[model samples]
Target chain A: MSTAIALHAPIEAASRAARSAPAADAARADAMEATLRALVDAVPTATLLFDADQQVRYANPAARVLARLCAPDKADRPLAVVGDWHPELLNSGALHLCSMHGSWSGEVILGVGRGQHKILLLHLSRVGADLFGMTVRDITQDSMRESELHARNAELEVAYAKLQGAQEQVMQSEKLASIGQLAAGVAHEINNPIGYVNSNLSTLQRYISQLFSAIQSYEAALAGGAGATEAESIRRKLDLDFLVGDVPQLLSESREGIDRVCKIVRDLKDFARKERSEDWIKADIHRGLDSTLNIIWNELKYKAQIVKTFGELPPVECLPSELNQVFMNVLMNAGQAIRDQGIITVTTSVAGERVRVDIGDDGEGIPPDVLPRVFDPFFTTKPVGSGTGLGLAISYGIVSKHHGTIEVSSTPGQGTLLRIELPIAQPR
Target chain B: MYRILLVDDEPNILSALRRCLASIDVGELDGEALKVEAFTSPEQALERSEEQDFDLVVSDYRMPGMDGVEFLSAMMELQPAVPRMICSGYADRDAIIAAVNEVQLARFIGKPWVDEELAAAVVALLRPGSARARAPKALRAQAASARITRVEQDDDGAIVLRSDDPA
Candidate 1:
């Protein structure tokens, strides 16, 4: 309020002095107007004033510069009309708003020439009775910076999506590489059943032909009224009794062989099926273990005997296929740990709300120095080119993803025990 | 009579071998009949080998306690003159090299052996002046004295061969 009173005292004094000497007052008024024009002209904002007839009364230096760029034809002709340079102001009705409210301010994008454009902040106000003043501030550079920021943000979103796709691809390739490592063992397992089954079929065919020859001989003996002695000789020579007794056994054994091959294939499919969405469902842990064992049985059969001590288990919420992969990796390691015959004991039990699976091998155990690094990727005790070294590491990752913990305990030259603990239900 | 020893871990394979050998006529073996003594375990087969002599021995390459090469190597120690062969479903290169170098294998017949080829291979092994035929007559007589008592089935449904030798 004191500053307002100080400003009012100057104006009141000037007016009082003007009333005393009209000629001197006119000279002073002209000097004051010149000072105001110099101040407005120095500002970066383009300033303009209009008279009651809506004609340009004053144009500051900035305003004149704008006129030169925007309307070169009217550059020296004087800004006779406000609409000539700022047509948007008339179209936006901001001038009508200013007449009613005494002031208006907004941002406007104005086309200059040759399809070029500039952003301007326009402020219009009534300076005196029937007189108006306006200011325009160029703000095109500020808007350009904001749009560049938005474009950069969109690029970042695309990059993030690509990274997610790459991560999933890595997971898939790792699974396939693990299978390729086990392909030899699986092939051997299937070959065994197929070999016997194929042999069995050939033997069956020979035996059937022999039986058929015996039947033909008997028919001839009966039709020609030959003595029964000839028929007995034919039976003994053809070994009909042996064929009758062994045919059923051969068929059953061949069927069993085919069934085993089918089971191995089914188990492999169960273990290797891709979970595209990584969907979690309530699944039986025993089934996963059993199927995994079936798939890797060839790797273990020659080296170790598997012993199972399964306890009652509730349906645990988990990814069945990924968990099976973990089982296969651990079991394969257990098999490789044994140089000769040994025992691989698999035990599962529930303690409180956690389900525990323990896979123990009575094989050449890990030494103290190598025990801690077992879960590290590319760590292998086997000779190079025989092991991928990712078995245990991948298992660790899978178990951790299930919100579980895998712990290993070992004694040098005794054995290694891998124990996994998982919650019965996943936390929401 | 020609005594042939067949060993494999899978009982189905043993049965298939037996059936296949049964189809070979006595005429195919120089008028001599074949008596196959098949075992699922190499250790038991080795124990049986100690009591009696076999004309020819065919064993699967992979087994639980002992592989074919190891069993044949041990067999060579007991009976140096007996002819040994390996019949395996998986022909592992290392095992084949070991069989050739260590056991002096008579033949390496793959599993799912063609009836004619396997029979022909066996006939060639048991021909006159072959390893089995070149054995001393006294050893053959001694093998004839040991009698097979009875076939027993174990808990796992494997056939167990029992033999008795008169003192």
Candidate 2:
């Protein structure tokens, strides 16, 4: 992400630019040689005088310093400097072209270090027969400044991308929080009415029982036929016997319906209670799995046959509500993965100190390429609007929070198995 | 003959509790006087209980003005030995624990209770020398600071304790 360019490139249009450039006289080449040498030495630019053999004849202070940088031992010597490191300096063809042409100016890059370079401006002119005056200017500093600016721009791009990801996570949590609050409110509202209705139904049931006992007592009292005709007529007209037989069964059925509603409301409340707190508790994984399964039973009832194989496990330390959410998310995903009929088998076991839970599904298995990316946020095979794609992501976070590891292995067209191994006690 | 007081914000709920008293086996109540009084207001129930001695008090956890915890605690101040039970749909964990420790709530009946379950709880509380009559304060204090054990289900099935609620 770096950019480098020579701003004052004096060589590309040297035919016009050379008019302002400092140059040695071509007319009085022999007469002003001494004066020209002194004038060139006074210039800050590195000026080198080369003989016909490409040897260094005379170098000004700047040229001497640059020579030491590229050629250390030959700094004091007037012999020709090695061309390997500064081949561009010597290979620019300025000297060769100056012999055939009037004036030659060109730009060449010279290696300053192993991988770094300096843009040098080479100006060549014939001072006398087989002798040439050359000026070199280093322009690497400006080029490095441009490169550093570009590198910083690239770093900012990486940082912005990370910020976007973090922001998305925050928004997701907020969304869940609002939804949880709404659910809790609804659960509470439902709870009050259900409470009264449940109580009333129980009272009705008791009243029915008492009425039957009263009828039994009346029958015993009238067994002597003291008021038999009148009582029999009243009973037949009111259909008392049928009423006594049907009411209890009807009440029992209504009781069942109330139970179902209570269970649903309980689940709704649990779902609404956000597990935002960080308090860790000793939790039983098996019980959480069943409640979660019952809560989300409708989602899987039609999709797959669930098989549960549980082993003895110590109560693992965790947030029960959060774990319930994790289980529901994974279970729902498993149910949705199946297109038609499939089997989702969940098994738990104790492996020494770690409790392991494996949820395996025989459905349209994840493709090899997509299997590894399942836990990535916003990654989903479900259609748009059907899934937010954060199920596995949240699950991953919850499991990680518990100091647990979740791994998934899948065979395309066969099945996928996700194993979550958690420590019984999370390390502080 | 023993008289029990039932307090709830809902008149219908109070009436239901009155009917539930009939279903409770009288033999289990030591052939005592079967009188069930119902009240819709906690203040009135408390005020009346002060004038007349009640053998037991069954109240809903959430009520208007005063919740079951506050109402029951105030009642305990007036009559300390009366057995009390709270029936609630939901309450904060802290408040429920407080109710248990502060008022010595005899038992907690979850919402949507069946007739038989309510009757059974009443019978258990009324029986002579029953643990339900007097809550153990020391045990409640110990339980208040006890380690939290959270249980969940596994793959096979859940080990479920029989719930007093209809479910």
Candidate 3:
């Protein structure tokens, strides 16, 4: 009877222990599920899980808020309840446009919801057979800033272009006005000789007629064997030797005067010719320098000595006259810069598809601050009446028009170099 | 006796030229023997040249109504054999090209000219059969053709002709 009671006790105790072990396993599983729910609720991003049929099997606390804002009944309901809210995501499996949830289409915006705002970057990916995971983030401030930055950049570009155009116009007008003023001086200088030559020629013609008549009379008197008294009177009154010698000299002087006047007139005409655009030819830049030197020779020759180092440059296609103006401006400036005997060096060479010309002056160098503003229109360091300050500015414009570049470099008390680079080929 | 046509827009220059010419004589050539018809206006010179003829046409390149090239071209049309001489203090590449191409000039004298060079240029131009009077018609035609072709090519290409900036 003791053995029987012991065997029953052991069996009953073993059965109780086995039952408690299953209950502990079930309790551990329930705690793990609760921990998972807490993690999803604490997550900042909206996350949702769908079953094979796209029904909302699970939605985190944040996802619930998103669903309520997008489609209030979609939390525990079928995903089809919110299908109209994101029809694209349903059809294409995933959609990335920000405005998918808002009135503004195709724009990135934060989707606002109950007690939370999500960037709501909608992304859908298939997890298994028909199950999917949707994720949303928040990026509200970044998108707005990017758009504003782009607009600001565009405005800056427009402002820069306007500034460049205004600078160019002012430079061009200054050049034209200077040329007009110089033209008047050139005209006046040429007219002085022309006036005198016209008057001298008329006087000379009258002298010749009188001399011829006198010669004829004297010859007739000598041929007719006039009386001694008549011959004596003719010799005394006429002073035949003086009349014959001095009259030819006077006539010759008159002829020379007329020649001088002709030359002055011709030069004036050449200087003032109307500008023409019919001829666009390939010209040697050296020729332009030479011509400019000739035009401004008077201004330079007395104060400066020019040194030329010409390279074997190819011909450049351009309007020769306009280029001549550029050279004239630079050369004149070089001459004016010198206070005493100084060297003006003009060097040319072929650089790539362009020709580079360096007009350097060994005069007082431009100050560092002034160097940067040399090409600014109407900015002159010279006295008021001496410079219009358009020389360098106009040169800059002309170079730009030719699809060229002008650069300046200077060292105080040393000198300045004006570099002009012009393409050999014409601007297409 | 050589007849010289002196054209200048300035009356002062005309008077000075008259005085200077009166002072010098080459050999037995009397200053009075040289007939000079001075025109302060280019139009007047052109009209006068058409009515008669001149041994030489001395003209200024830049004038109010017409330039030296145009004036010379007109003069050459009326009298092809007459020699044209251009003198200018403002001798630039354009003036040289115009003198060479448009005027088919006899000589280019830059100012302020020396007395000897001035006399020699006048004498040479006046010399019988000394001047080469042919103009390059082919070059002018080629220039025109090239311009047309350039315009056509620009049209065919996608080059935007931006409007001139009003700034």
Candidate 4:
């Protein structure tokens, strides 16, 4: 350890002057010492003073607090243990380094609070002959705040990713909704013409059948005998019975053919009516289901037999038409799933405050991977224009509007069950 | 022979219903079974209906001259024994509810109804003692159960069996 610390010239000159005039100005020198001590104590920096012997002399209040970190048992902060710029190197390395370089400064970590380490900047410099000064600036709080900011930034990035996913779903739904509105308008406009044309066709059929009937009757009368002159002339010429019977038979068949076209139009009209909106009313779910069945019967009647097991339930408050749409979508899907012959079972029951409807089918069931995404917009197993891929998606939306839930479960080849749980009465 | 009066604004509809009833009246049986006084104009139908006796009246609900409810109500006043049938489409729900009160032997025939449905309605109107005749609309519909015939393979690759299918 160095016996003397390199001191600054001005401090040495002042010390020399104090030594020489001490006898005549001892009181003034004493007052100067008190002022310097008070200034060091007032500063927040932890500062320490060492005497010519390189031993600790004076320690301000800040220095005393820092000393407790290294020397927990000591009342006096009498030393800065510096060996290779390490606090654990409790030796006079700063004292020796200051003598050669006139100053030394570096960052170090010290034991501060019960097993806690604190970052600190330490500076050592010569102040007078054989004297040294040390200062420490604690930097623990600054670095901690910096790390917390980094963690917060990472959290924000995750939240933004989730928000983007939700936005995409909303956009898809909006696009499909606009298309539905257009379809409804087209359907409403076509209703009237279909009505009259349909009636005309049925009548036309009746006419054909009647004409056929008259011809048959005239043939029968002729087969009996061509004896009466008046009757024979009328049968050979005007053929009154033939005109009446043949016309009716032919028209009846023609009307039947026209009626087929009318049905297609009517089914299309019902599909468009999904867009028609009315206030919520207490309505029979069975009625909605039945009407939906009638509308889509052509699709199902060939592929599947229907079984209805409806429970006794009070009329549910709902938009009857909208619910009809939901039923149609589910039922049609069930029918399409069947490759050949199958059975579709529709069961409705009241559970607690909810009305539960289950439509199950013994058909080619949904794949496990596909089932989860069945209600996702634009997700479909059908090829190209065979479907719009919005059936289940729209069904989901309608159920959601009614504050209800729809879920499906299926096995690969066994069957599928779609369950709809709706509130009995929606809040007005 | 049963006498039926059929009226509609549309010429095609009047001709169609008249022919259908004419076939049913005259066909299948040995001779003409019923007489239909068919007219395109409601005013003309009203004139003819007053000049003759009709067992039943089936009229289109929507007409430029007069709605079916008003037409049926007028028929109710003139021929109290005759059943009044309205062929209505999506429209006229409110009017039907109102007309149901004034009309005797009131019957509603949904437009684009199948041959079987029209036949049943005709039989019910003529034979008042039949089970479906006195039953209310809802009950009658229930009693008219869906008839599923034997399924047959169609050329289109669908196994379909249509029995009196209007659609």
Name the 10 consecutive residues with the lowest summed lDDT in model 4 chain A. Answer: A1-10
The residue-by-residue lDDT of candidate 4 on A248-366, one tens digit each, is 55456446545755765665555445333457788899878876776566446545789999999789988777777678778878988988789999999999999999999999999
Q: How many steric clashes between backbone atoms does each model show?
A: 0, 9, 53, 35
TM-score of chain B of each: 0.75, 0.74, 0.68, 0.69
DockQ of every candidate structure: 0.36, 0.13, 0.08, 0.08
TM-score of chain B of 3: 0.68
Error of 4 at A7 (Å): 47
- Give the number of the best model, judged by DockQ: 1
Best by lDDT: 1
Model 1, position B16, has a per-residue lDDT of 81
Off by over 4 Å in 1: A1-169, B128-167
CA lDDT, every model vs. true structure: 0.76, 0.67, 0.61, 0.65
- Candidate that scores best on TM-score: 1
Predicted candidate 3 versus true structure: per-residue lDDT over A210-319, tens digit per residue: 56766677778879987777766766654555546645655555466566556545533433334554567798888777756655554565467889999998889876
Which interface RMSD values do the candidates have, in the order shown? 1.7, 10.4, 9.7, 11.4
Q: Write the per-residue lDDT of candidate 2 for residues A1-428, one digit (tens) a residue.
A: 01111111122224244455445433233334446545656788877666667665666767756666665545554434425226556764666789888568876776656576667667887776666767777766766787898999899999998987785565457347434423433343345456656666665655567567657756775885648666676567545676566456546544654676677667656654655457778988998888777666634654578999999999999988777777777777677777778899999999978999999888777898898899998898878755777778878887997889989888877888889989999887
What is residue A218's positional error in candidate 3, in angstroms? 24
TM-score of 2: 0.43
